[model samples]
Target: MAVPGAFVSSILLLLASAAVAEIQFSEIRSDDRPIIPLDDFGFTHRGWLELNVSGIALSKAGLELGNLGFFLCTRDSWLNVLKELEEEDITCALQSSHVKHVFTFEKLGQRTSFDVEFDQEDANQYTLIFANCLQQQLRVSMDVRSAMYNLDGKSGRRDYLSAGKTILPRVYYLFSLIYFVLAGLWVYVLYKKRLTVFKIHFFMLAVLIMKGLNLLCEAEDKSYIKRTGSAHGWDVLFYIFSFLKGITLFTLIVLIGTGWSFLKPYLQDKEKKVLMIVIPLQVVANIAQVVVDETGPYGQDWVTWKQVFLLVDVVCCCAVLFPIVWSIKNLREAARTDGKAAVNLMKLTLFRQYYIVVICYIYFTRVVVYALETITSYKYLWTSVVAAELATLAFYAFTGYKFRPEAHNPYFAIDDEEEEAAAEALKLEDEFEL
Candidate 1:
């Protein structure tokens, strides 16, 4: 038994050493020139290059123009693609110049075949196209092929194609459907009887329509059709409309703030003023971000400007959300102090039904995610926006059910009594002054 055990141990040790030796050999072999010539035109005619499978390579190359060879330089690009595939459970690939020039794939087999073809008869110019090969999987590939071909004019075409066919159109149609349904329902409720909450709901519906229109315009422009959606006037309008979308958030903040102010009348004057001040400041900052993004260093230095805007927007959002949440908490405490159980129940009911506020919070969180994606250029972040909007629409639709005139009568009566008391107090003060 001891002899057998000793023999087994010796075999395991030998296998481990052999594995280490193979790894070391691979590292050494990978150092050799990546490009191997099948035909002897050595420097002149470059042929299909096979990636070295022995070792890991970086993500992107430092040198721009060179013979197609196996090397990776930008680590983030490769990691990002892998992460998207893993996290989303979707197949992904590098298709165009937007991603790094190098492509990375997990070694699944001995060899993987890639097909290449040139459209125009220019030996100097060749396009290296990467397509999705995963069976029954949605693959999102970056627009990175133009860089490989050195095709200046056609650089944006493939990306635009993918955006039109897959991304933008889908988003546009989904949002449009949601907007129409919610808007129609709200209009029907208004015809039955007007509700103040429905006004805000309608406003939200309008926002959805505006967003859908903007996306539609973008999609139409990118689609490769006869009329190449190139209306510069419309483009300018879209830019302005995007800026307005950011401003609209401030409007929501104001609406929520006013609602909170009504619920908490004892808030310090200074705090109230500060909250008001933050609203316009946030609006200005958001507009400035759009301007800077369109006309300033953002065009030249995307990464830096993206980070700056994200930081600013995040700070502003936190500044706004914090006070509102604090005010809501204070209101809840104050409601508890009311002596009558009936009054407390009414207050709790009103508070619980503030789905508008909840929807707005959801919207704010979505904005943060959108801003982060803009900075990081992560494609997956877009799906979050779609989900958020869908949720907001659904919440608003449900909230509309409580818009009957009878529901507001109780609150309105209370409001009238308060107004009468305030008027009487004011008359007393005026008489004393006289």
Candidate 2:
């Protein structure tokens, strides 16, 4: 929810610096996402905008106005507020403003804490605007540290979370719970076939555990922020787990694509090269995620970091496909050359299916979910999370089912009769060569 890279910007409410953070406007910034977007992310981050004003250096005109020179309004009404401020007869601002908080400049010290509030009637997203309306050479300058806190009222929740993503905490937890169940099931399967289970099976389980932990941490991060404007150490756990999950996930994908631990005990030189490239790319991607989360679009290098994250993500995705392609090609050639064409054909089909599934998983998470987020309403943002998680779960299950260990597992196991036939064929070939 309100974890790193949760929202598109730094408008999230930070409660405690022990783990989570808040949006701090060190200067009166430009119009690059200056209108802070407020949402509950499913009330996982349900909190209010608590603005701490500092360096209250204002002009004579600002002193005359006697207000903090900020405006909070619903997103729809915000544009109207701006349009109204453009006209000379702007007395309507005090009356027409959707957010009624008036911060008087009188007795305003170097640091003043102003808690912002709004009514529950309006069913829409709220935005915080920092501006000096008079527009005469831009007079007011202040350092604002805005923290989000949960309003512990039913009416307040209805008002603050009008965009309706309050279901995200539950959504993540629900999926986390599902993964927990799936993990249990996987363990059972591994135990039942413990004699047949390979090292890759255990690796798959670790990936599942990491993914579960990541989602659980994310849910807690949002929930903690919602309740107290801080995630304590939950945010830290989230970031750590998130990084682990990312790295492990890509590694697993690359390993599985190359059929490592199944068909081969060690990576080939070229396969090792692929891991060398993919792992570092994942690191870059995770670091970019953190930077994007902590710094807003207002930050100077925001665009560059966004580009870095996107580029690295796409490259990593493309990189993982290479091993799968090689595996498929190798299998196709083996099916033609191997005397046991029946067995080789089975392996070939499995690899082709693996390639298709990997492509689909990448497409759904990277491409489909992105389009869903852009096209859907703010209220349905949780759907993107759900869709991505579901696709991942399906992929995981399919991989487990198709590759689970067994004596007669067509993928890796050959019948005794086929083995005998293959031996005879090899004997004949050797005799002919001699």
Candidate 3:
């Protein structure tokens, strides 16, 4: 063995050449870069590319590949990839229990390759080895780009929401703007009418306008967090608007559902009491949702309290059913006696039923879609919700406009007659006392 010094030197030289030959480095130093659009043209071209890239190379280069695509998560390349993999709890399966401190290297140009063969047949073993080599900053001569060329599929298509960006429909925002204008006009009309019956109509229109504004804000900016790096304020406003809309709907339902002359005073008091209790509870629940669930920086758990508020809202809605039944019974009794009161009651009842029918349609559609994933895309679901809301509001506004109180044909003419009768009864009681 001592007599083979020349042979030993030759063997060392051969090993060095083989190590250098494994990777070929080439660099093109011209500015003629390819312009890639964000969409696919045909089968030949694509917007994204995917290949089984080495994670070690990605860590060293300060890039990471996730379902969301490539991200330069941090300036520290090696730390960034490790952190990302650790977050997924995948880095603990490395072949080496600890990364080796001493690692070989060669300084070459770009286009690095790992032509070295491995005995491990498991593909994940190779990934672990690459991760270890990267952690040690070993012989990665040039930038090793193991990232797969992928078609950055930005389509929001999935059974459940996936990491993707979706283009929002602008038409919904335009329609929401129109809805806002119409709601505002109806509110003005209600103000001009100056009748107690139309006050509920005014409140309902106001809530609809707020909901439209919330939709418009979401359309303007789809980001959960804002450009200012702050939590979105519009989300809190949305919850408030939604809660108010629900409460106002219940109030209107109770008002129109109880169409009896004898029991009208008691039912009106009950509506006021319901508002007094429900409004505060709704406000508090919405505030809790905003602080803890919606735009909160902490645990964004919406399921627990979301169901609670929804249950409260549903109960309030269902409570109106009894009033509606009683009102129908009262109307049938009144029809046998007072023709005019019964006619007005029937008209109001029809309007209320129409409103409830439209609301029920929307509620049922949303519940079904959300529960069973009937609609594949959440973006489309949002659009449908806005469309439903706008359509319902338009129909309600049309009905109110058509049957608005006027001097020639007042919608609630019985109200004035009833007030006159009450005043006459009071005068007779005073005369009897005298």
Best lDDT goes to which candidate?
2
Model 2, runs deviating above 4 Å: 1-49, 57-69, 72-121, 131-141, 147-162, 411-434
> Compared with the true structure, what per-residue lDDT tens digits does model 1 show for residues 259-362?
43234434466456656666566666655555443432102232344455656666655555544444455444544454333343454445444534554655
Model 2, span 255-313: residue lDDT tens:
99898998889899999999999889988988898876666433546556877988999
In candidate 1, residue 81 scores what lDDT? 42
Clashes of 3: 13
Per-candidate Cα RMSD to the true structure, in Å, reads 17.6, 8.2, 19.3
Residue 218's lDDT within candidate 3 is 52
Candidate achieving the largest TM-score? 2
Give TM-scores for every candidate, taking all chains together and pairing residue i with residue i. Answer: 0.47, 0.73, 0.47
What residue runs in model 1 are displaced by over 4 Å at the alpha carbon? 1-159, 163-165, 195-233, 260-301, 326-330, 333-341, 349-385, 395-434
Model 2: lDDT to the true structure: 0.63
lDDT of 3 by residue, 367-433 (tens): 6434433233322334444445555565556545544544444335457676455344433432111
Q: Report every candidate's CA lDDT.
A: 0.38, 0.63, 0.38
